[model samples]
Target: MTLIYALEIIGTFVFAISGLRLAAKKHMDLFGATVIAFVTAVGGGTTRDVLLGAYPVAWVQDTVYPVVILLAVPFTFIFRKYIVNLKRTFFIFDTIGIALFTISGMQKALSLGIHPGLAIVMGMVSAVVGGVIRDILCNEIPLIFRKEIYATACLAGAFAFFLLDYYTTLSENIIYLITTAIIIIIRVVSIKYDLSMPKMKG
Candidate 1:
């Protein structure tokens, strides 16, 4: 596989593991955990494909992503005890995964010659939808709604990517890296400092 594809695969697998671990913490059984992992890993890509008319979605066509997520489940199960209190670490990895996924989604849409604004939305969908589905399955408020700057981080990265592509001579990979880093920083720093969206007054 190409390097980019490999990075995406790793990102997907990590996100799936994080999802599976979360499911286990909620005492979900094997079937539920697997379902959560599978959906978390590919939900974003599925949405992106549907919106892009890419048909059948990517994970539907390739067994690789699904298989990777499947393998991740057991490892999570085996290590669940030692990692039970790793919420912060999970957030870090999950945030990074979405950051990269957001950039990748926007890049895919851009490469397809989609409009920039639409591409940004697609990027947000690609990063946020997967986690949203996972949270719904777990009967929790989606991370986007709860804390740690979730969707905001993804949107910020997506916009950063778009602007970098538009107004800079930066290489494509560099743009992705910068955008991902910005999202990661926002997410991590917010978590560290308790920063968040403001509450609206009635």
Candidate 2:
């Protein structure tokens, strides 16, 4: 498979795992967990596609997306014990997934001749909307709505991607790697140091 397609599949898998992990914590049944996993994997992409007027959406056009999520559900259940023992398993997976989704989504928009600014917004939406839906379903404040640096990281990555594509001589694949790394690093550092955007006083 192409690198972009592979990255998309990996993103879907990890996002699904993150959602399944939360569902498990909520004591959801297998069916409920699968539903959560499915939404977490495809919600953002679906939203992006619909907004862009890309009919059929992504997962609807590609069976691989659903298959990947199906695999992730069982994988999460099978390794629940090991995953629970890992420090910040959900955070790690979610961060990586967002980084991947941001670049992939931006690339899609760019390919469709979207304006760069809106492409960046699409990238952020693709990265965060799924998690937002997942959080709402889990009855928690979405990370993007919180003071955390979640959506900011995606926006930063998208901007970096646009600049690199415009001004640099780097290959497309290399740009993708750098953009993803930038998002992941920004997210990790922000979380590690308790950094966040300024909050408004009441």
Candidate 3:
């Protein structure tokens, strides 16, 4: 498989795990957790595909995505104790998932003749909308709605991808790696330093 496709599968798995973790914490049953995992894995991509008029959506076309999510549910259950013991497990997986999804989304958009500016927006949407849906379903405030640098990190990565692809002769794989790393680094640093966008004043 191509690097981007592999990354997309990995992203789906991690995002499903993140959602399953939350569902477990919420005392959800297996079916509910599976639902949560499915949405969290592909909600953003589904939204992006619909907006871009890419019919059938992504997970709809590829059985692999659903299979990955299904595997994630059992994996999360089997590793529940270990996952619970890990500090920031949800954040780590979610961050990595978004970083990878951002690159995939932008690349897809650019390939489809989307404008760079809109492509950046699509990238951010692909990265964060899943988490947004996950949070809403879990009855928590979505991270992007908060002042945290969540979607902003995705935006930065998307811009980096655009600039690198436009100006440099770097291989596509290298660009993907650099963009993903940038998003993950920005996310980690922002959370570590308790950094966030300024709150709106009344």
Candidate 4:
């Protein structure tokens, strides 16, 4: 559990740094960048926790969360030039983070006796809300909307995780690894092909 907590916290920090770097790119002040980063890191988990009734929220209880985010601010500033080009790099890491988080969310929800349908929704929420918050803070449309495959990839992974869970023949670690790989594969292919949800003409 310690290692799991460390990884999740690291994911949060990476997202936070990514968001702060973006804010810096837009010439935002330190405070604004910090806010953006902090929100981006934990927004998805917070949303998932709320929906799962897993309150009063994970970050609220963990002191390390805010501290790690605070540490990310300096890293963002110091590496502004490199970090600014991180749209591609961040996409890869963020995708992995969500995949892991998605599986974790589903496992937790199901263990707590949640319905499968709702558990699936929880997985997607856990996966993508970080980018949504980052986009909102950066004054851009949500990434999951513009890049439809991002969330959908997570959804696909969530579904696969559910199927694996239903069978339970696979080891827990194997299931999670497969679920993450499914998300990464779908997202990479979608981006490569410029795939998107069809725009509607209202």
Candidate 5:
């Protein structure tokens, strides 16, 4: 499979796990957990595609997307105990998933001749909308709206990808790697330092 395609599958699986992790915490049934996983896996990309007027959306275009989520959700649900114990691992997966999706989304928009500025917005949307939907469904505040550096990390990563693609003569593969690394680092560091955007006084 192409690198981008593989990234998409991996991102789907990781994001699905994140959603299922929350469902497990909420005592959701297997069916409900799987539903949340499915939504988390494809919600952002579906939104991005629809906004871009891309036909059939991504999951419909590639059966592998849904198939990966299908398999991943059950695996996650079955290993809830073990996975839940590894909070750091799950957070890493979440970081990597968002980073991958951000670059993939921007690449798609750029391929369609979209302007870099708007493509960056599309990238952020593709990265975070799933988590937003998942949180809303779980009756929790979405991460983007919270003090978490989630969406900002995505936006910064998208901008990095755009700059590297346009300014540097680096290969696309290298660009993708650097952009993803930047995002992962930003997210991990933010979490490590308890960094957050300022909020209004209560």
Candidate 6:
């Protein structure tokens, strides 16, 4: 499979697991957890596709996305204790998911003849809208709505991907690697240091 397809699958799995882990923490039942996982895996990409006028969206076009998410539910349930106990488990998965999806989304848009700037925005949408919807459905404050540097990491990575693709001669693999690494490092460092956007003084 191509790197883009691989990233999509990996992103779907990690994000689904993240949603399942959160659902477990919230004491949601199996059905509830499954719904959350599905939404968390497809919400962003679906939104991006719709906005870009990509027909049928992704999940509808590919059965693998939901299948991966469904499979993740059982695996996560079986290993709930181990998965949840890992250091920064949610943060780690969420960061990786965003990193992978951001570049994947940007590449998709670019392939469709989208402008680089708009493609970057689409990439951020694909990386962040899922988590936002997941938090809203769970009745929690979405990280993007808070002072957290969550979506900013996605934005940075998408911008880097755009620049590297348009202005440099970097190989596609190198561009993907660098963009994903930048996003992951930004997110990890932000969490470790409690970094966030400055709040408005009320």
Indicate the worst ten consecutive residues by lDDT in candidate 2.
81-90
- lDDT of residue 192 for candidate 2: 95
Q: What's each prediction's TM-score?
A: 0.93, 0.97, 0.96, 0.89, 0.95, 0.95
Error of 1 at 48 (Å): 1.5
lDDT of each residue in 1-202, candidate 1, tens digit only: 6545765787798789878888878998899889988899899989998989977688888899888998997778787765557776677678878887888888878989999999999999888899899989898988788745678888888888888899999987677678888988988888888888877779
Q: Which model, 3 or 6, shows the larger lDDT?
A: 3
How well does candidate 4 score on lDDT at residue 9? 73
Task: Write candidate 6's Cα lDDT for 37-69 as tens digits.
Answer: 999999999999999899989999889988999
For all candidates, the clash counts are 0, 0, 0, 0, 0, 0
Which digits, one per residue and each the tens of the lDDT, describe model 5 over residues 32-108? 99999999989999999999999889899888888898898768768867776798888898999999999999999
The alpha-carbon lDDT assigned to residue 79 of candidate 3 equals: 92
Q: Pairs clashing in candidate 2?
A: none
Better of 2 and 6 by TM-score: 2
RMSD list, candidates in order: 1.5, 1.1, 1.1, 2.0, 1.3, 1.2
Model 2 bad stretches (over 4 Å): none
**Model 5 — TM-score against the truth?**
0.95
lDDT for predicted candidate 2 compared with the true structure? 0.92
Give the alpha carbon lDDT tens digit for every residue of 1-202 in model 2. 8898899999999999988888888888999989999999999999999999988898998999999999987787789887745758778888999999999999999999999999999998898899889989999888688877989999999999999999999999999999999999999999999999988899
Quote the positional error of residue 89 for candidate 4 in Å: 1.9
Error of model 3, residue 185, in angstroms: 0.6
lDDT of 4 by residue, 1-202 (tens): 6434655776787778777767877889888888888888888889988877887798899888889999988876687666667678766767777777777777767877999988889878876788787887678878777745777888888899889978779987778778878988988898899888777889
Clash pairs, model 3 backbone: none
